[model samples]
Target: MSNVVAAAENSYLAAFDQPGRATVEPTPRPGWRQAARDRFAELGFPTKRDEDWRFTNVGPVARTEYELAVAPAAVTLDQLEPWIYPEMARAVFVDGHFVAGLSDLDGLPDGVRVGSLAAALEGGDVTAHDHLGRYAPFDRQAFIALNTALFADGAFVAVPAKTVVERPIQLLFVAGPGERRMAFPRNLIVAGEAAQVTLVESYVGLGTESLTCPVTELAADPAAVVDHYRLQQERTDATHIALQHYHCERAANVSTHSLSFGGGLVRNDVWAVLDGEGVECTLNGLYLTRGRQHVDNHMWVEHVKPNCNSYELYKGILEEQSRAVFNGLIHVHPEAQKTDAKQTNRNLLLSSDAGVHTNPQLVIHADDVRCTHGSTVGQLDADAVFYLRSRGIGEEAAKSLLIYAFARDIVDRIRLESVRTDLEEFLFSRLPKGEIVRQAV
Candidate 1:
């Protein structure tokens, strides 16, 4: 066994009373982490024995060597001249620890708190802690337990009742240069009754061989609306594993948009639960990979109450010898009658060497539920490409145009226009360097 796995099992067993593993410091948890860690040790990493992970492999993730990252180098705003966003409240974290001086949180409204998890906990913001690990049962998932055991820093936002935050809270997580460096970021967003907010979490890297394991949990109370977007663009040799868990209450509306473009090996796991009546949710994702890179996105949407609606659509583009995987599951419980849920996944392969595996599953224990799922994987339409070429378009230009049109369908579904434009620009710039990105969309 690798040292990291050995340390994970033995270190926690040794310090059962102290709570949590050692990271930047000994920030004790409120008793939940200890129980969860013990369970993780007994269960170990999930294998094909676990139905949920039957098709996915954790052997590589389990044996990888990862260490907690240290304090980043002194990179100030003046030195960060290339990073800029439009009129957004921003917070910066380096090596998984909040750097207040490096952050720009100006123009934020009153009654809204945007800070780090460590700082918030030290300041006695205990109300938000109640729902931290409540959504997903960490006892069954090793990664969740590992994150709870080693989490050091991440963005924390809490909106009060009946308040609307006009500006979006932008979070940037930077992984500094170091060998075997690992960072764990935990983000918690809670929107109170009738509250409205938007949150964006962006992950980037300064080094090539780093590991970033992140977990984000969002909670929306009754009649609340929340828009969450996660953008991952890391170094080529880095490995990223991220999980986003969201819970919605009665009449709550939640929209999640994900863009995965970088990293040597990246996997994004999103789970959203609608527990209250009349709750509505929309989950959209886009992934682009080339070379030998590997990208996977797994999503689960559960409806536990009646009269709820949900929609899911994920698009992917793979090139070279890269591989992509998409697994989507929608479940409707017996009490969740009148549930309307639709799910679909589409993939475009630019080269014969590229590979894509997509599957959409539905489990319904309710009779009156309206649920459907479908998946498609194929190359560019030759008819469309020929038509474009006949209309005076060059061969390369025609192929690119057809490919871009396939991806544009999902891009147009993005509610934020600026984010959509930025994503398009980033993809466009990368396409010239890769066979897949060069495609029109």
Candidate 2:
């Protein structure tokens, strides 16, 4: 093993061995924690030698000596106002600890629970313990194992059967002012049978060079409908690693959207398993990178039952010397006959120095399954730019207009008005002369 990976493993194992660390929370299954630590120690940190992490190297993260952040820094609502959505029920966490003063969960519907995971575990909420580490298996992935063993606080949401939540629930995680400090945030969301809910996970940093590792588990029971959004807007010097595991039952519908705009090094891993017949799943993502930043998105969908449907679309806008990676896989089991799956990945490069790697795979064991996958990497269409320039638009404005038009294909799918508006504003600001296109729209 390399020195960097060895150092990282030792640091985490030392922290895990600290007295009182394992008993910090009254989790029903304490053995899971010890097992996670052992798994992490066995696997160590992933490197370029690993097949899944071949394109992206995490040596910088592994080499760094980081301490766990335990205390909430001095921050106020005014500083976080820019990222807050007024229409959603917000739950705030600072430095891996839930802060009640900054959260607003008023007027929630009956039988709906939205709050902190730490509180639920301490208050003896059996539901939290029952579903916390059930879906996200940590034995194979080192980062997931580290998060499962170290995470102290995160969001916990549950929607009872047959209830429809009018407002969305937002879980906002803010990294405070600290260099070389790390925070582990874990979330568990359960949607009962026939329940409907929209949940958002947003990560923001206070201009600090920190590390944020988060894991979220989502369970959608029979006939349930879930819309999940993950937004990452951290400091350019920060490193963000996250994992999301989803399980869909019979006839359940689940859609996830990932939007990433910031972070020095970012990796997002999403896995979904359709365990019952007639399940529907959709995954959508958009990533914009500039400077020397690196972003990666890895997704896997397993069709374990027959008559299931899945769709995936991901797009990237790269500029300067930035880089991005997209890896998607679709697997159909022998029993999963008549499965329909499709995957597409598209990337647009604004600079010749920018780079992107896209891989889409389909593995089918049933002859009746229909699965297709493709990827494309290209630059802006010169003909479209020339056409716009002939119509009295400047060269820069015309290029920006064409780029924005290409991105709108995914933005138009956002159902929430506030989220769409915020995303549009943010995307426009990233272009050279995007104000012209914004005004035209």
Candidate 3:
């Protein structure tokens, strides 16, 4: 076996070798972890030769040997104040383990439950047992297999039938000051029949050199409406790989938004399945990169029944020597007649050294389906920049204003006002002479 395999396997055994660690935080499921462990041993890691990973390389991740944190890192509430929203329920995870002390769920309405996934399993909650490993199978991806086998804790949320949550629930994962350790965060969200809720999965860490792999699975029952967001705000030196799996039942309406700002090497995988007729699914994303950062997004939407609808739009902004990739597919099954699916990917490059690879595809087995996909890559419009410059704006500020105008198309789609407002401020602070842009808003 390669060093990567040997090092990762040793960490796994070490987790079990420590007395009380296993008993303190048992696997989410008993047999599933072993199954995933076996899979990881067999598949190891994916190379660039793999079709899905043709342009993205994991060699840096594979070659490095990272230690796992033995306990939760000490994190203060003051350190978490920036990410927490007022009057919103939140589940907090520090150093890959859920911390009830840092989380708040006091005002959650009836039929809504939120807590640690490990706690739910230890308590023998039937819902957690029935749905934990049902959607995100680890057979295809080694990182996913690693997460399944080693994730000690994460968030668990359940909203029962016909219930409507007034505010979005936050699943915040923070990495505190510690050794350069690896972290796996696993989350599960289940919405019952006709229930409505919004979920935000935020990953934030600063000045830490580590590898973090997270997996989130969402199950939307028939006629359910769920708005979900996956936000990545890691340090520029961190490595982050994340996966999202969504399953929608008949007449269910689901929307997902992805916002990425940091990380040295990042990969995001999103797979959504419309399992019943009359389902509506929408996916939107925006990513920003500078310096030597690398970001990749892989998206797949499957239409299994007739009369289902899905739309996807992803936009990216790259500067300096940054690189990115967007690979998306819309699949219409044979029985999915009258399916309507649309996909689009757009990118703006701010420097000559920056580049991107975009591929949007449609595979239709049904002749009656309506499926379309397109992708584009370009630089900031010279004339538009000139127009702004002629209006007394500095050269740098003019460029920043135009970039903000281009990115807001995706940010404006967010339904949560708090998140949208915060993101706007973050952008302004990052831009050159951003005060001018903020006033323009």
Q: How close is every model to the real structure, measured as TM-score? A: 0.90, 0.97, 0.94
Residues 320-362 of candidate 2 have per-residue lDDT tens digits of 9999999999999999999999998999999999999999988
Instruction: Give all candidate RMSDs, comma-separated.
Output: 3.6, 1.5, 2.2
Candidate 3 similarity to native, TM-score:
0.94
**Cα deviation of 63, candidate 3, in Å:** 1.9
- Score candidate 1 by lDDT: 0.78
Rank by TM-score, highest first.
2, 3, 1
Candidate 3 clashes between residue pairs 3 or more apart in a chain or in different chains: none
What is candidate 2's CA lDDT for residue 427?
A: 76
Q: Candidate 2 — what's its lDDT?
A: 0.88
Clash pairs for candidate 2: none
Q: Put down candidate 3 lDDT per residue, 1-441, tens digits, no spaces.
A: 567456645555455344534232334556777778788877767778789899999877776667666567888889888888866788998877889898888877887889888888789777777888788899988888888877877889999999998878999988767656777888889999999999988888843787889888899999999999888888888899888999999999999999998788999999999999999999999999999999999999999999999999999999999999999999999999999999999999989999999999888899998898999999989999899889898899999998899898888899898889888998898788779889988
Clash count, candidate 1: 4
Best candidate, lDDT: 2
Q: Which stretches of candidate 1 lie over 4 Å from their true place?
A: 1-29, 48-50, 54-56, 70-73, 78-84, 432-441
lDDT, candidate 1, 153-190, per-residue tens:
78888888889998887888877766657777878888
Alpha carbon lDDT at 12, candidate 3 = 50
